[model samples]
Target: MKINVMTDILEANDRIAAVNRQLFDSHKNLVLNLMSSPGAGKTMLLEKTAQALRGKLRLGVIVGDVETARDKERLEKYDLPVVQLNTGSACHLDANMIASALPHVDLTNIDVLVIENVGNLVCPAEFRVGEDFKIMILSVTEGDEKPLKYPLMFRESSLLLINKIDLLKYTNFNLDEAKANARKVNPNIEIVDISCVTGEGISDWAAWLSGCYKRKFGTNSLA
Candidate 1:
């Protein structure tokens, strides 16, 4: 009975997600769902990506967290359309939450929408929130075993950003092992090493994002 209920919930969520995807497609907006554990620098990466891609593409963000609007506050400096969804106690964001937040942002004017899912490696990957790509970030501080232990996020993501390389020397994390495990799960996942603090590899990440945008909307990104 429990399994059937869970399956039904996911099916319903997928139906809403398909609707959301169609809405985004109609507006020519490329939506990226960003997920990571707590303290993995998801917000910081967005700040840097926003700066890197500013003017090149019109951006909007949907910040999802269990509580508090702190992440939304940090992103408000950009003055772009921002929506904060506080799930209260939910560990992850779902398609319904995203569908609720879409009305708050002007989807017609935004070229790309970044949905920052609540900090969790498990449930977030199970739910699709109408995104073009799921970009997962794993800080070197989180250790190399994460990809093997939390294989779903690694496998489900289209791109993986190994963040916080500045602390790589201090920590015992192995870049090779991390890449090997991630590649084992997702053979085609595009992985990039990034440090949001020092601004390392931000351009590559931003370029990949913009490339998706240009490919989706063509040369004229006025949409």
Candidate 2:
């Protein structure tokens, strides 16, 4: 009975996700669902990405958190349209939560819509939020064995951002081993190393994201 109930829930979620996908397709916008564990730098990456793509892309952000509006406030500094979805005590953001926030965003004018899912490595990956791609961020501080311990996020994501590289010297994290484990689970996952503090490897990440947007929307410039 429990298994059946869980399946039904996912089926319903998928139907709603399809509707959201159609809405985004009609507006010619690319939606990216970003997932990560708590304090994995998802908000910081969004801030940096928004800043880097400023003027080049009509970007909008939808931040999901269990309660506070902290992430939304950080995104607002980019001066772009953003909505905050406080899920109360929910551990993850689902398609329904995203649908509820759609009314506050101008989807037609937005070239890229980034949904920063509630900071979680597990359940977020299990739910589809009507995104063209899923990107996951893993901080070196989270340990190198995360890929093996929590393989689902790495397996589900199209891109992985290995963040906090600036702290690598202070930790015993093995970059190669982490990448190897992730590849074993998902061989085609595109990995980009970045450090929000030092602004390292951000250009590559931005360029890749731009390419993805172009591939999905068919134009190079979001403007």
Candidate 3:
């Protein structure tokens, strides 16, 4: 009975997600769903991305958290259209929540919309919020066993950013092993090593994102 209820809920959410996807597609917005555990550098990556892609791609963000609008506050300085979605008790942002927030954003103004999902690896991966891609961030300090333990997150993600590589010497996190483990679950997952602190790999990440936008819209002009 419990499983049936959960299944029904997901079905409903997927239907809403389809609607959201259709709306984004009509506006030619490349939406990215960013997922990670707490302190995995999701917001930092966005900060760097906003800086890197500024004046290149018009950007919008939907920050999702369980309670406070702290993350939303952090991103407001960029002067982009930023919307905060406080789930209250929900661990993940569903399609309905995203649909509710859509009115707050001008979809016609932005080329890319990044949805920063609640800082959770498990539940966030299970829900689709009408994103073009599911991008995961795994900080090196979190250890390499995550892919093996949380296989679903790895499998569902289109790209995985191994962040905080600047602290590689201080931590015992093995980069090779981590990549190996991630590929074990997701053979075709694109992985990039990045450090938001030193600004490493931010350009590569931005280029990849831009490439996605270009591929989708088939235009060189981001603006």
Looking at model 2, report the run of 10 residues with the lowest lDDT sum.
1-10
Give per-model TM-scores: 0.94, 0.95, 0.95
Q: What lDDT, from 0 to 1, does candidate 2 have? A: 0.90
lDDT of 1 by residue, 1-223 (tens): 3454335658889999999999999988999999999999999998887788777888889999999999889999977788999999899999999999888889988888999999999999999989999999999999999988999999999999999999999999999999999999899999999999999999999888877878877764553
Query: Where does candidate 3 have its weakest 10-residue lDDT segment?
Result: 1-10
Q: Estimate, for each residue in 121-162, the C-alpha lDDT of model 3 and write its tens digit.
A: 899999998999999999999999999999999999999999
Find the 10 residues in a row with the least total lDDT in model 1: 1-10
lDDT for every model? 0.91, 0.90, 0.93
Clashes of 3: 0
Q: List the residue pairs that clash in candidate 3.
A: none
| Model 2: per-residue Cα lDDT at residue 172 | 98
Per lDDT, the best of the predicted structures is: 3
